[model samples]
Target: MSRHGRVLVAMSGGVDSSVAAGLLHEAGYDVVGVTMKTWDYETSLGGSGVSRATSGCCSLDDMNDARAVAVRLGASHTVVDIRAEFGDWVIDRFQADYLAGRTPNPCVLCNTHIKWAALLKRADALGCEHIATGHYARVREHGGRHVVSRGLDAAKDQSYVLWGVAQDHLARTLFPLGGLEKTEIRRLAAEMGFDHVADKKDSYEICFVPNDDYRGFLARRAPAVADLAGGPFVHSETGEVVGRHDGYPFYTVGQRKLGIALGEPAYVVRIEPETNTVVVGPRSALAERTLTASGVVWGKWAGIDGEARLGGRIRHRDPGAPAVVRQLGDDALEAVFETPRTAVAPGQAAVFYDGDDVVAGGWIDRPARAQPEASPEFVALPTL
Candidate 1:
């Protein structure tokens, strides 16, 4: 029914992507399924061990499932090797962020740089007019500008990680699973006779990091992280050395499992990577009213000037809070929350929203710092 001639779909060997490919093909689009080989478990682990399960993306088993689904749909499928790109863009950035005492979300990087950017290029080379994925998000064109919106299924919405996607690609991108819920997708897959992946479990762990043990992965991949001398945990308020830690790279901001028994519960307030030290404080000290972020990507509103009232989410699961966002410089913005938020960690994405639509987003540059209350003139408007 649609006008698209040839479409390239990124099949992750999961029920969602398989169903997406099927739906697109049934709708009269020439679908070509492509699975990206991001990492090899044996090579990443240096052959020390093999993964117990093959449920995650990029695994040998996932590729096979993807191929099978493509065959069933009567579509062509190919495996693209992206291991080198994944290592440099995702793995290296993850290790370096931790080494610099910041927690990094490799999934966000992978989705923005690898999944969409790299695949879009390949789609063009293969004479495909559009590239589709299984992400639970929606894209719409309003007033001739492409906008990214949250999926109809709130619980399964994946728009948070997709805010960094470039605006130009939005027109050429398709999210076939955006309007449907996970339950409905599974039901459709079953009806379509995709029983092999219909009941498959979703992967939550990082694909390259086996067993979800990031600490161990970093120790093996980047041994220099261990050579850094241990430092003392300094109390933020009292300014006294309370305990010692193995190394600063092993910890993250807002972490509570320091292994040191301070009489009162303390959380990591900030990490000083330059001095290899961690600042700890009581729970109350974690509240923050303001945060500065960099790498600002204005998804729909690209060139608006001055200040704007918006809802800011520091993490993916966060419900979001009212804030006034003001542009600080070319690639930076400062957001002051109406009410203080807790555990606003650095190196995490801070996405802004105008109702259900994603307005803009950026990476948190540092741990949340204390700031005075917002001025009355900059208060955010109430959400409808």
Candidate 2:
């Protein structure tokens, strides 16, 4: 690999990104570190007068930490203000999804629409040919096309959230820690005297919601969501009135704890925002065999002319299931799992994989019919 070109490193003040910048600099590349100011901590946190240290990424403390690391590596560092874009793309979409009775994956949206998109533009403006980040994923070139594959560390693989990244952008994106495990990355940080963030706790909550109470955050940010009238919880099959729910947005599909006293266990089978109703049933009712998705993004192997067998995952932590995937149109696809799976929720992404490589992915549009009368004819779309 040539090391003479300039590369922009998206630093998050964490050990992962900090080590990424250091590794690139050691490789003889001219590295420039940039941290995105995604939001104002105080304002986003409801101006609770809390310290920035407790807040998540893009806080003042994080910026300072990133700057200190850049100084240690003798690299230039700058902060890019992306608060408005972040709000418009990620935060607003999050609230809207809940209001529409669908669980949302904000991380995937942020990676595709906000973080990488912003970094790529800035990298071009700074005369950098490539942009590097701390994402635990790998990009490989095969047969003249770039493909995104799972990172070496399966436990830390982030390729799921990155399926939305376009093929062209993957060509110039870099994941410095893709080949290394989490433990190795920490050890390298420690050996390089970056002890400050070497052991920092990994942030799992949404950055804008500091307390991680998304329900409370939505109530405050979008009050209309809270004012939705309480509705009845009905049984999916029997259509019997079981109990009442606080609101439709408060519950999610397959949630067992419906807060109502029932003789036997019950699970949320479906959420109907139109009727302001919550449907609950026995755990067996949650099993689903088919799901339809929209906003599909194909990976390296594009232009599927027929049904293709691939692995599908509905949630981030789910062990993928075997399924037959077929493109329905330009932006839609249908996946029929070989066996029934549970907790398949709408608005979550359905990512398809061929072995370790991400083949294609899309947003779950609706609960598909268990068995379509006939499979839709496949149509070949433009290759990415």
Candidate 3:
């Protein structure tokens, strides 16, 4: 009990986080449960006002769920209005990246700029020395430094999205679900007399787009991008015009639906917003060995630099493969792998690692064609 400090728990009105708050409160630490008003998905969806937060974070329903948990646990709870911050840091970037035809990782941006930055600051103001969340990841400190580690549940590990976060944040952050699996977390919630979470299905949609329709959201938020419109969808090999689209931003790499069907099964290989073109290719072209990355954060591996070879997961679900990382410039790096990977889409994140430790990460750019050029300008990144 004395080993832990006062913790500010981030409640998403979900079982995992609410139970996290309960555990900390039961463990003798002063715990304040706080929910962030992270996004205005309702406003984007043409709702009159706030939609019922029954399913999404920061919704009225979510607020009630969080408030209910606080009352049940006899812990104080408050909601912080972070809508504007989330808008600038996450929503705006989401829109822009789509307009540019580069798939964006909004969760990564939100965690880096919103949760730890906005919410962590609020925790400090509330006299809390540590912050806790429902994340299914573990934190370990070794040799006077902190490292974010995988939780027991590999399928739900969110560490991939959180690699950009620093040790300074990890030192002050807590993951209550790190040790316990999802089933046990709910069981504890039920035992604590919390029925709201007895069988809550995990909310999985991009928090801002629950229905999974980003085009409608995009057209409303970025009218100019809509003006730019979409161009032709073409077969990668034959360059045959197969179909047309309203916007390339609406699609993702490896997406099959909403795409013009070729005689053979095809996947999205590239989306060039400049030409408003979507390149369709056979699955084989998706295999890529390397990715050039930018906007890196040295979360675990800080002093170690120069030719850092490690395993990598280009997207969250893919297995880590052996790869090498070379610093292109101060802010960018070119990553080459011993073997090729499929669907390594541009504009998505390619996170590097040494075993489980997140060594570094950045945005994946288009791979060099044919030659596998080791070094390009590693071009100075354009201001985002």
The candidate maximizing TM-score is 2
**Per-model TM-score versus the true fold:** 0.92, 0.93, 0.90
Model 2 scores a TM of: 0.93
lDDT of 2 by residue, 150-255 (tens): 8999998889999999888899998999999999999999988888888977777788877677777777777786566568899888888888888888777778
Per-residue alpha-carbon lDDT of candidate 1 for residues 1-384, written as tens digits (9 for 90 to 100): 345689999998999999999899888899999999887666566633556354255678888889999999888999998877887778878887887677788888888777787788789989899999999999998777788899988888889999888878888999999999999999989988899999988887788887677777888887787776568899889889988887888887678978776687889988887788888988888898889888788777774499889989998888889999998777688899999999887888999988878888888875456322121121221121
lDDT of each: 0.82, 0.83, 0.75
Model 1 ranges off by over 4 Å: 1-3, 52-55, 367-384
Sliding window of 10 residues with minimal summed lDDT for model 2: 375-384
Off by over 4 Å in 2: 47-50, 369-384
Of the pair 1 and 2, which is ahead by TM-score? 2
Candidate 3, residues 41-129: lDDT per residue as tens digits? 55765642325543355567877888899888878899888888787668777876776667778888777767887767888798889
Report the Cα lDDT for candidate 3.
0.75
